[model samples]
Structure formats: structure tokens, C-alpha cells
Target: MMTQLLKVVPEPQAILRAWMPFKSVVGVTSVRTADDYVQARATVDALVDEIRADEDHPLADVLDYLGEQVKRYEDVHFTIPEAQPREVLRFLMEQHDLKQEDLADCAPQSRISDILNGKRAISKDIAKKLARRFNVHADLFL
Candidate 1:
């Protein structure tokens, strides 16, 4: 006799309804302690996985809830620093393998060196030149 394997498929609507109570629980616990990280992350991961696995799942609702949780977690943990002008210039130069001499058409090599060495500020004129050369916003270098 051959035995058939039974797959326990959950109804999407039912899963969504079950998710609501869990979401509330996670929301209440999200700011409590470092211990909450594992639980919160697990809840989000499970919801995302379920949504991916079942197209019939309330994808928009799941995504919205997951996005909120992710934002909350990131707000608590991630802090991005503002990039300085010289650092931006150095990053751009390194990305393009540009030499200081190559920037002469844009600005003087000494000016580029001074900016990179934190001895000079990026003036509006140089910012525009860099913007044009790099095809990026001037604010990036400012």
C-alpha cells in the first residue's frame, strides 16, 4: 500500500486574520528590549515568506505591515552620517579611477588635492564643475 503525503495548506484569508493579532503583539513588544529584535524579525520574516509563498495572500496588507515594522526596526538601529564634500569627491574619483590631473579641465589639480586633504572647501563653481563632469546633482558635492 502506498501512502500519500498530505500538505497542510492554510487559507489566505485565515492566515491574514491570524496575522493581525500577532502584528499587534509585535508592535507592543518592538520597543521593549534587545531581546525583542529576534521576535520582531521572526514575525516579519514569517509574514513575508507567507506572502511570497501564497499569491492569494493579502499581499498589499502584508507588505504595508512589514514595511512599518522594518522602518521601526531601522529607526532604532541604523544611523547614517551626512557625507562631507571632500568625502563625496574622493568617492566619485575612486569610482571613476580619475587622477587629479584629469580634473584640471573641471578644476585645478591643487584645488582637488586641497579639497581631498580637507584644506579647502568645495565652492559653488567647483560643485557645478563636478556636477557636470559626474552627471550628478551639485548638492552631492556640497
Candidate 2:
């Protein structure tokens, strides 16, 4: 049955011709078509299921290949923004339910107001205090 299916399906090279752009982007010239991607995904999923069902299965190579392919696809598709100082500060304030007055222990109420409103920058001392209070990296404020 597998041999028959292989015979019916176009070879990997033929598939690559149809999916050259995606193949080039993923650095995988061997993958030829959308069907090839689907087949690879299904193979990876099956390997994962088999590994889950039998932990002792010798699937190291399969797992490594799946991880590489998945990572390549994800890198080309998924993007996440890095946190900025203002965003980090806002997140901390929201998480702690803190108001400008609540920051009096760290800085003057006016300073906190200015910092929150982006009117004033956070100094090293303030960054340290905020890092301690929010349990975050001080560099986030810098």
C-alpha cells in the first residue's frame, strides 16, 4: 500500500518545483508542494503520538527532525514584540494595582506621575527600586 501510494504521488523533486518560495525561505529545498508540508506535518504528529504512547520508543532522530521543521515554520510565521520601558512599567503598575500615590515609598508622587506619563525618565536608583518592587530586571527600565 505504501509503495502504491508513493508511486501515485509526485516525487519530492516535483513537489519542490511548486513550492520553491516556501522551500527557499525554510532552507528546505527538498520539500516540493503543499502536500509535502501536510505529509511532513502528519508524519511528525504520528511520531509524537507514538513517542507519547511508548516513552521507550527510539524516536530521538524523529523528534529532532520534527523540532527543526516546526521551528523553521514558526520562525517564518510567528513574531512577538519586545517589551519597552513604558510597557514594562505599565504592566507592573497594573499587576500590583498601584497608583502614583502608592509609589511614594519608591519616589515622590510627582516623580511617579511624570514617569508614568512619559514626562520624566527613570533614573538608575528608581529603576533599582522598581525592579525590587516588581521583581523584574532593572534593565527593563533602562
Candidate 3:
């Protein structure tokens, strides 16, 4: 005599019923196009605002899921080159329409000029000041 194996499968109707509301509320099952990716990105942003640094928040896993989806789309569609700290600072300054003298709160004009010219590195104190001024993390400067 031979033993037979049993297989179990979920009911498709039940799965669909459960998934319909979830997909509607969550905005995506997966990112398939630019529009879908945008919706997923917006949802992820909302989740981040709600979740902040709380790993135990109810929607933390949802944020992680959508973040992964956005990352997948970006990895396929975008190529971000690695930028040096000086390059990052330059870009931020340009975006803010800032001259070296405008960063006087963070550093002296000469220091800022040296940093832009790659002659001086940004110290932690300067990084913190820039982060506060630009509303960005200090790690970008470091």
C-alpha cells in the first residue's frame, strides 16, 4: 500500500474579497507603471509621516512594503551616481540660491569657499549648522 499526500489551497473568491478592500485602501498591490509607482510613493510618504521613528507602529510594515516597491521601480528606472560631500553641499547651495556669504551662520565666508573649492572638509560643528539651516540630516554634509 502507498500513502497519498494531501494538498491545501486557499479559496480564490475569499482571497479576492479580502484583497479588493486592501488594494483600494493601500493604493496598490504592486507598482506596475509610473502612475502606480507615484500612488505607491505617495502612500509610502503618508505612512512615514504617520510612523516616524516608531517601529512598533501598526503601519510600519506597510511602509516597508511600499518603500521596497518604490525602491524596485527606482532601481529599474533611475541611476543615481554617488556624490561627494562637497558636491552634495554645492547642490544644496544651488538649490537654495545661496552664495558662500549666505552660509555665514554655518561658517565664515572663507571657510565656505574653501569647502566649495575642496580645500577644507566640513567639520561636525559645521555639518550640524548646515543641517539645521537646510532642514536636512548632517550625514549629507559629512
Clashes of 3: 0
Which digits, one per residue and each the tens of the lDDT, describe model 3 over residues 18-105?
Answer: 8899998987869879999879867875775566556699987877777778768867885435687788889878855778987777
**Every candidate's CA RMSD:** 16.5, 17.3, 9.6
lDDT of 1 by residue, 11-83 (tens): 9999999878976765643434555655655565455544542436775465455446545765677532468
Instruction: Kindly list the per-residue Cα lDDT of model 2 for residues 6-52, writing each as its tens digit.
Output: 44778899888867875454343332455545555555545554554
For candidate 2, what is the lDDT? 0.62
The superposed Cα distance between candidate 2 and the true structure at residue 114, in angstroms, equals 0.6
Q: Would you estimate the TM-scores of all the predictions?
A: 0.43, 0.42, 0.54
Instruction: For candidate 2, give the lDDT of residue 114.
Output: 82
